[model samples]
Target: MHIGLISILSLVAVVSAWLPSDTDLFGPEPQTNATFSNLSAGKGRVVKKWLPSSGKIRGVNLGSLFVVEPWMASTEWATMGCGSSKSEFDCVMKLGQDAANAAFKAHWARWITETDFDDMASYGLNTVRIPLGYWIDESLVYDSEHFPQGGLAYLDKVVGWAAARNIYVILDLHAAPGAQVAQQPFTGQYAPTTGFYQDYQYDRAYKFLQFITNRIHSNTAYRTVGMLEVLNEPVNGQSSLVNTYYPTAFSKIRETESGLGITDNAKKLHVQFMNKLWGSGDPKSGLKDLSNTAFDNHRYLKWDTSVKVSQAGYIAASCADQVASDGDKPLIVGEWSISPADAVEQSSAFEVKSGSNSGFYTKWWAAQVIAYEKQQGWVFWSWKAQLNGDYRWSYKDAVEKGIIPKDPGQAYNQGVC
Candidate 1:
């Protein structure tokens, strides 16, 4: 639970030699590889190809694990003296560093275990998208920052367990130094003003990216961590963030790979970026100058207010979605689940649709899997909810109830879509 300030800050010192100055424009070299043999595919601008073996990545997200969102673990949030706090930053502030660290230590210890990974393998899931806060490298976190320490150790356990089960890990930077957007607990804090665009915040996030990219490639414990999602759901309107930040991140990751002698096309981690943004732009345009990356697409019909509420409507929407990216890059549905409610726009996403009629959820799940296989693949929004026992959001619950098949690849209601 203590900070390893020295080791964490060393990441900056190392990457500083290759990092581009803030004023300089950054982009990728022209991609030469036609098709990345096995891992992920990126077109246009890329270094080494890291295409998937199965073409599609069948996975689930380890939600509310490293970055604790209170609603998902309400009981632990309250018992750990975090009931009043929405984000881990606030929770640490309220509980004081020591108590919060103890709570998180225990929470992370059991949130998901080796048994969970075994279950995933049994269910035929091959990947886990883990959401981590920047504070995982506690040194970059300012003294004023209030996130708990010692997340990296827990992450080590996770990847080790995952690798044993032949499951890959997609390390996602879910939270940044300053919240990427204002008032979002998932970003690690909720505040009226967003500060991720500031110079210092951008630098910290960059350092963390360098740190993780290096760790993924260097550590034997992280052998199964084949993907590094650069950032998760960053604010959409920042042009500089999309243009400069992304290219720089891509460059830094390649630099890390080079430093570690990871020149092979197959051994590299697939750097993932959002396929599209709300206002700014997408990877195709922003990252036009780079490759050796994958695009992330998060789909949800509940908040869309675009898809109909009826059962057939959900199936149609799933079948109609374009899982394939506009460019040649692999498209990953990083976060998605069954949105059963009508016209409700909540990121908390309580889709407890499977009651007695497993028929409905079974059919819908198949429709999505069938459709998503067109591109790289999809990872469900979550593995399980710790407290609520909501079947829709819990892959374990759904699997047990026969809502989602034990063998996820086998679509129960095949051709139903």
Candidate 2:
């Protein structure tokens, strides 16, 4: 959709103000009113609430939802290849420009809007996490004239579509500058150390979070945008790295956006301290962490053919306990993907394959896990990704006839109160 002339002009003016230098999108003012509020004792568990008449998650089951990265939603998009070249910034800039344009087109927009969400809602999904790139917000970049209007307008449309169907949208900042996942898509590089802890990149990330929190909280339509994921799969190689930065960033965001109240005060502080303590690896730091915020963790079992899933249950339980010990705060399995084989083996200690037991195994295992941990909510690994040939990870297949049965798009509408 074409952006309104007024918005386009306004964005152009903003862009001109920061052409030569990347100005701070989040101004220097200290947001003071933002403070954490503690949850009452015994009320720390993930409670089931029904969706309000406005079609939002109020009280409901912590079920899986199909997630799609709309910023990467393009027919021509490919895995990270440009970063391997010498001039990484040039390559990234070129790719980013192309991606931005392609994402704006109606073709990509309609594909994600029509196919992904509609089909996911039909597949017993209560929520859909849409991972947007930090660059999408023109206000953050301050150099792109087309960004503020185009990106914001497109996202506005996305939120409107989901709200109409009562589908909860989790706004995930997947492609943070520091490469939250430490690899392609975010940094356009593969296992590179140079991009790991760049100060400027981290600064950019902090700014992006502020921009997103401000933008979403400002729009009433996005109240359905339940949570803001600080970072996606922040590598555990060194806990100190994130621990030192996360709290600082979290404080900045909370101060900037008062609407995103510190819902679970104790839990939030605890997680932040845990992140720092874990990063620092200093047990005797004598840091007492607070609690009351939702903690995000991603898990893929050993059998998933990527990371060993054996530790999946352990990681989940451990994180839960951490939150509980500090205070009672909700834990969200921000991302996970386990086939029938992995799920069955984990749940009932039975090995299964994807072919013969595809249907039974998938359904049984998914239900088993969801039932196993009724408190902590989860959003499945992905709805789609850059893949080749026939792949189980393809949401296209799940939407068609793979994981979903009957009308996949309407499956989420069932049992959604």
Residue range 177-240, candidate 1, lDDT tens digits: 7788788888989877788876788788888988888776555556557678777887777887
Residues 1-417, candidate 2: write the lDDT tens digits.
333112322211110011000111112222343332222322242222211111212111111111122233333332333323222233345557566344335333554555566666666565666666665555455352222125556677676566566566667666566455543544323334534355677787778777766655455445345556566545556554455556656666666544444343321221222222123332223223322245554443434343334324433432333312232234455555434343544343333323443544344334423432333455555566433322244444544545544333233332321
User: Model 2, 245: alpha-carbon shift in Å?
Assistant: 1.6
Q: What C-alpha lDDT values do all the predictions have?
A: 0.71, 0.42
TM-score of 2: 0.59
Quick one: best lDDT, which candidate? 1
Cα error, candidate 1, residue 353 (Å): 8.2
Q: Compute each candidate's TM-score over C-alphas.
A: 0.84, 0.59
C-alpha positional error of residue 262 in candidate 2 after TM-score superposition, expressed in Å: 9.8
Global fold similarity of model 1 (TM-score) = 0.84
